[model samples]
Every structure is written in C-alpha cells, then in structure tokens.
Target: MKLKDSAIRPTAIAVQSPASTSTGTTAGTADRAADRTRSGVLLAALGVASFSLTFPATAWALEGLGPWSLVSCRMALGGLIAGICLLALRVRAPARRHWPALCAVAGGTCVGFPLLTTLALQTSTTSHAAVVVGLLPLTTAAYSSVRNRTRHSRTFWGAAVVGAAVVIAFAVQQSGGSPTGSDLYLFAALLVCAAGYAEGGQLAREMPGWQVIGWALVLCLPVAAVGAALALPAEPVHLTGHTIAGLLWLSAGSQFVGMWVWYRGMGAIGVARASQLQLAQPLLTLVWSVLLLGEHLTPAAPVAAVAVLVCIGVTQRARG
Candidate 1:
C-alpha cells in the first residue's frame, strides 16, 4: 500500500536533520542576535555613566553661570564639536527626509531638555534633580510603546506605576515634604528628553548613530550660537576650574559622545530594552552629586533607589 503525499510529507519533515543547513543558519542568526544584544547593553551602560555626571556638573556650574548662559554655551560648544567631527569624518548630509527627525532631536536635547534642566538646576539640588531624572527611563519606555503601537503586559505597566510612585516619594522627601517649582521643570525636561530619545533611536535604525546626533547639533548651530551670544555676560567669564570643568564635560561627554552611544544602543537592542539600562543612571548620578556637588543623600534616597531598581527589573521581565 502506498502512502498519500501528505503522509509522506509528514515523515520527511519529521526525519529532518538537526544539523541541516537551515538549522545551522537559524543558530548562526541567533548567535548574531545575542552578540548584538550584549554589545548594545555595554554601550548603553557607558552612555549612562557619561550622563550620570550631568546634573551634578550642571548644578556646580550654575554657581557661576546664568541658566541661559549655561544652556546656550553648552549647545554651542556641543554643536562645534559635532560639526568638526562631521567634517573630519566627511559624512554626507543626511537625506532631506531625515530633516524632520533631526529637528525632533535638536528640539529635545539641544533646546528643550537642556534649557529646562539648566533652569531647574539653578533652583534645585543635584540630588533632587537625580531623583526627578530617574523617571526618564519609564517615560522613554512609554513613548517607545506608543510609537511602535505595541502593548506591554499589565505587570509592566504596574511596575512603571510603582517606579513612578517611588520617584515622587523620593522627590517629596528630598524637597522637605513638598513638591517644588524645580520638580515641575525637571518633569518637563523628562517629557522632552523621552521624546527625543525615542525619535533619535528610530532614526538610528536607518543611519549611523554618530551622524544622527552630529547632524542634529549642526542643525541647531545657528540658534545655539545666537542664543549664547545674546546671553553672554558683559563681564568677562572669570572661569573657576570647577565651573570650566563642568562646562567642558557637559559639552563633550553628555551632549555629544554619550548621545551617540545611546542612540546606537537603542538601534541595536531597541528602545524599550535599552531604556531599561537607564534605571542605573539616577543611582550613579547620586554618587556623582555627593562627590562633586557636595549634596547629601537623604535616608529615603536608598529606599527609593531599591524600589525603582526592583520595578525596572520586573518591568524588563514582564511580557511586552
């Protein structure tokens, strides 16, 4: 008796070798995926470390510089560095289609978030700013979900809510039991910063990460330069070593290099998982705040940190 074609097909499929070419290709693809994931996590961690100093450094520099002056100078300097890099590398201008996305990048990091954070730091301690900025990763994740039209599990949303509560509690405890105007500014900064992160990460999928930031900086050059010029003090900058050091770090590390790596990581591992790595940033920022800005951490700070960390971990494990 002869078997039908469907019966024969089933036997043939069932007898397929594990070491077949197709299976080998699948295994190789998975290995590459794993490698990309590991590389992206490391890059994200480095980016986070570079950014950890920002709030502390900005607060320290605000002692000598006006908020507008600090924001303008940082943007101008960052733009110059990015321009020089683009020229030296001979990177072509991004396609005109990318201009809108570049505008989003410039608006968020170069203009909105930096300006708002500088103003906020003029009135807030680095420790308080760190707690407020801790809310950023969740914001980024939320934006990512909306942009991708993906749904995360209820557990993930729950974890985010818990994390937000911890941040609010920490902010209140640090602010002597009430929210302040500075917290409001930092909240605004988070909103803009998250938007930028998501948009830049999306752009990075199609272009080089460095090119994305470099172009964004170049696009904002005129505005940044003009703002810095107008905001310049009539008196010569009597630069203190600490203030100058802070400004340079903000210009070189946080504005340019950190963003380059961050976008690349987001492109590689995706915005959602990459943003999870940022949960470590606020903790690191507090360390920098204590050592650099002489801000003392409150008793509740550690509790908040632990709670946020647990929430982040839970969110990562939850289905999306």
Candidate 2:
C-alpha cells in the first residue's frame, strides 16, 4: 500500500506542475509590465503639467518677490518636503563619493535653473521663457555627446543648429526695440540654467534620479537662503495673495511633485523618451501665458513650437 501511494503522488505532481508554473509566470510578467506602463504615463503627465505651470507661477511670484527670494523660498520648501519623503521611505544616505555630482546637479537645476527662469520672466513673457526652455533638450544632448566623446551624426548637428537658429531668430526679432537690463539678465539666466540641466541629466544617469535631485535641492537651500537674505534688504518685499499662491504652486507642484514624477518616469522609461514628453511644456506655456498674463501668442510661437517638436523627434530617434 505505501509503495502504491508514493507512485501515485509522483504522477499527481507531474500532472499539476507545468500548467501552474506557466500560468503564474505569465501573469506575474504581465502585471509587472502593466505597472511599468501605468507608472510611466502618470509620471509623464505630471511632469508635463508641472513644468508647464513653471513659467506662469514664476511670473506671478515675481510680481511681488525678487527673483532670488522667490527661488530661495521655493528651494527651501521643496527641500523640506523631499526630506520628509526620504525619511518616510527610509532611503539610504548616498555615499560620500557622490557629493560632487549631487552638488553640481542641485546647484544647476534647483538653484540655477529656477533663479534664471524667474529673472527671465521678470522681463520676458512666459511664452518667451517657454521658447527658450524648449531648446533645453538640444543643449543637453549636445553636451552629453561631447562629454561622452560620442560622435553625433550630421543630422543631429544640423537639427541642433537649426533649432538654435530659430531661438536666435526669435530673440533677434523680439530685440528690435530697446532691451532692458532685466532682459539681458534673463538671457544670462537661461544660459546658466541650460548648463545646470545638462549637468543634472548626466548626474541623474549615475545616481538615483530622485535622490540626485533631492540632495541637490538640499545642498542649494543654504546658498539660496543666503542670497535671499542679502537681497531682502534692498527689495520691497510684499507677500500678497497672488504671490503666496504662486509660491505654493511652484514649490509644491513644480519643484517637489513634478521633479519626483519626472525622475521616476526617467527611471521607468529611459530619459530620451521621458524628455520627449517635455515638448508639451512650451505649447502649454504659450496657452497659459495667454490665459494668465493676457499675452498674445506671437506668430513666431507656432514656428518655434514646430522647431522644438522636430528637434525633440530627431533627438529621440538619435538616442535610440
């Protein structure tokens, strides 16, 4: 009887094994793939919305606050929120060796980028800033290829040159009248911010995307805070309802939530695909500028948008 039972058990195991194993594996793989796709879509949407409002929010805040003050306050608030999240998640502290890379990204993205965009919006319309920012990917790709010692195709260079020409042409066309000192300051800010973005993207490849940005904001807080404090004495600081709301949106929506979603999307789908999603930002900015600031969408807006779209497509294909 015992020998008969053992033989029966072997046959039963064999009969059940293949069907259950295959079913479980297929279901698990499907679930994971679905999750990744969902996450990617959510992240991309969040990044687009958050980034679109960036210029409008900055423009609103700068109505009362100085550029440095607005930037400093936003960074400080964002850093605080990120710190809480890191603590809640029990994320491990980054290694010492990563400090330089982290600082570079923080200074560039959190401090440098926002600071410049704010200053730019002080004189330029959100539409103008959007146009300038649309060129960010091209700048980043150019920097990456150079830094990585990778030779880009002629097409990549051509697209970059053409896109740059569009930006320059727009600037020149806009510059026919007397440009203010503030406008020059804004252009300087755009250049610096672009450098920050290129540096941040490179670092993001090595470090956890969230942590890289999180730490960068943390590092930049002190610098921003100090600058804000110094600038406060000379500026007429007023905290109006519009300014407060603008600050809240920029800090919470754009810096904190937007960046986390962006980095997460970058992790799930590679940066190249995630970046194409940013193409929506400029057009959205144009819309928002019209609605929020009553600024007209210039005829050049459509042309600039097309140029940015073409550049984004070219860059994405090149990356692939």
Candidate 3:
C-alpha cells in the first residue's frame, strides 16, 4: 500500500509540473514545425529536379518538331490533363477575384515561358540555357516581395545575390561575354515566369496547390488548342522516340506535376525560401545535359554548383 501511494504521488507530481508540461508541449510544437519545413523543402526540391530535365527534353523535342508546334502541343496536352482532373473532381470555377491572377498564370506559365524558352533553345546549348534561367529564383523572390509585401533577412538576400552572381557569371562566360539573342528570350522568360510563380504561390495559400495550376491550365485551354491546331499543320513532324518521350515529359511532368508540387511547397514554406531551392536546378540541368543530350560539361559547372549549394544552405537558415 505504501509503494502504491508513492507511485501515485510521483505520478501526481509529474502531472502537476507546469515546467515539464510546457517544455514537452513546446518541444512537440517545434518538432512539428521542423517536420513541416523539411517536408516543404523536399517538395520544392522534387519540383526543381523535375524542372532540371526540361531543357534536355526540350532539345530532344526540337529534333522532331518545330518550336511553335512543340510548345503549343505541350501546352495543349498539359491543359487537357488538368482539365480531365478538374472534371473528375467536379471542381467549380475559381472565385471571380482570382480570375486576373489565374489569367496571369495561364499566360505566363503555360504560354509565354514555354514559347520563349523553346525559342531560346534553338540557339543555346542546354547547359548555357540552364545557367541563364538560373536567375529565375532571384527574379521570383523579388517579385514575391513586391507583390506580396514579404520580407526576408539580410542573410537570405546576401545568399541569394551570391547565388545569382555565380549563375550570371556562368551565363556570361558561356555566352562568350556578350548577351546573345537567345539570352534575351531567356531573360524575357524570367520576367513573365517570375510573375506567374509569385502569383501562383499566393493562390496556393488560398486553395489547393494542384487546383491553382489545374484551373490555370483550364483557363488557357482554348488558346493552347488553337495554337496547337495552327502550328501542327505548319510544322513538320518526324516522330522519333526521343521527341515523343520529351514531349510527354514536358506536357505531363513539368507543365502539370512540377508546378503542382512547387506551388504546394511554396505555400508550406514561402515563395522566397522555395525559390532559393531552385538555385540547385541549373546544376542538376547541367548533369542532365551531359547524360541525356551528350553535351560536354563546362569546366565552370562544378565550381558554380558548389558555390550555389553554399548559398542555398545560408538562405535556408535565414529567417524571414
């Protein structure tokens, strides 16, 4: 009986200990937040990995189809994919207030970026193009700041600038120290795509991430369909295995799946942090260029990759 009473007393004491209870609760909350951040980082990383394949795939696609045809068809196919999902789920139209942003997303992501990048690839090597597009994260972060009134720590901006400088130097060196015509297209792509990404990230916070992209796809379906119809008849088709595979990936993996997870990650973490993850994308794309396109890896690629990774770590540690 004494032993039982002692055990009960200890239990009562433990249950009444405010400090212990508070500590446990705080630890649990911190653990959950850390887990959520890790998950968000993982999702953003996956999207970047998916995107890294895009340039090589686009190069492969160009082998058998004209630029206009390839872009239009991929857009059309991506729209169809999202449309089917929306229909199956019976998702209603987005609120009227969201339409403008939806239109921006549709125009920038589905059409403008794809068309410009495809055009650029006609003149640029996959590696060189990857480096130029590496500026996308910086652009996206800036756009998010202005549009959403988000703030970041100086460490974050410093790291982001360092990463951007590395990529910019790589881009200039790869371009023989002058902006080529293709570089202009890529830069233009950055502006529109940054807008799309910032807006999509905002929309993701209000709705399901996949649904944000899905609705944008649906909104652009008519334009994509018409463009595809016109372009297919104009462009010659060779139907190589590479072209077919590339088109499928661009349409399904990048246009839909990548953006789906990307927006979700942005919603989880933030536009700024998630965008920083893309600093690794050019490095990944460089690898893909060698493996898939049989392109030579530049001497600067390894050095740039390492520098960018350090910057990524710093940005990740920075508080908003």
Error of 1 at 195 (Å): 1.0
- Score residue 225 of candidate 2 by CA lDDT: 73
Give the clashing pairs for model 1.
none
In order, what lDDT does every prediction score?
Answer: 0.84, 0.70, 0.92
What is candidate 1's lDDT per residue for 13-127, written digit by digit as tens? 4566767978889999999988997888788778889999898878766767878888888888999999999999888889989999899999998899989988888778888
Ranking of all candidate structures by their lDDT, best first: 3, 1, 2
Worst 10 residues of 2 by lDDT: 171-180
Task: Order candidates by TM-score, high to low.
Answer: 3, 1, 2
Which should have the higher lDDT, number 2 or number 3?
A: 3
Give the CA lDDT, 0 to 100, for residue 203 in model 3.
Answer: 89
RMSD vs true structure, all candidates? 6.1, 4.8, 3.7
lDDT of 1: 0.84
Identify the candidate with maximal TM-score. 3
What would the TM-score be for candidate 1 when compared with the true structure?
0.90
Candidate 2 local lDDT, 183-248, one digit each (tens): 655556555655555555555556666776777777766776787678777677789887888999
Per-model TM-score on C-alpha atoms? 0.90, 0.77, 0.93
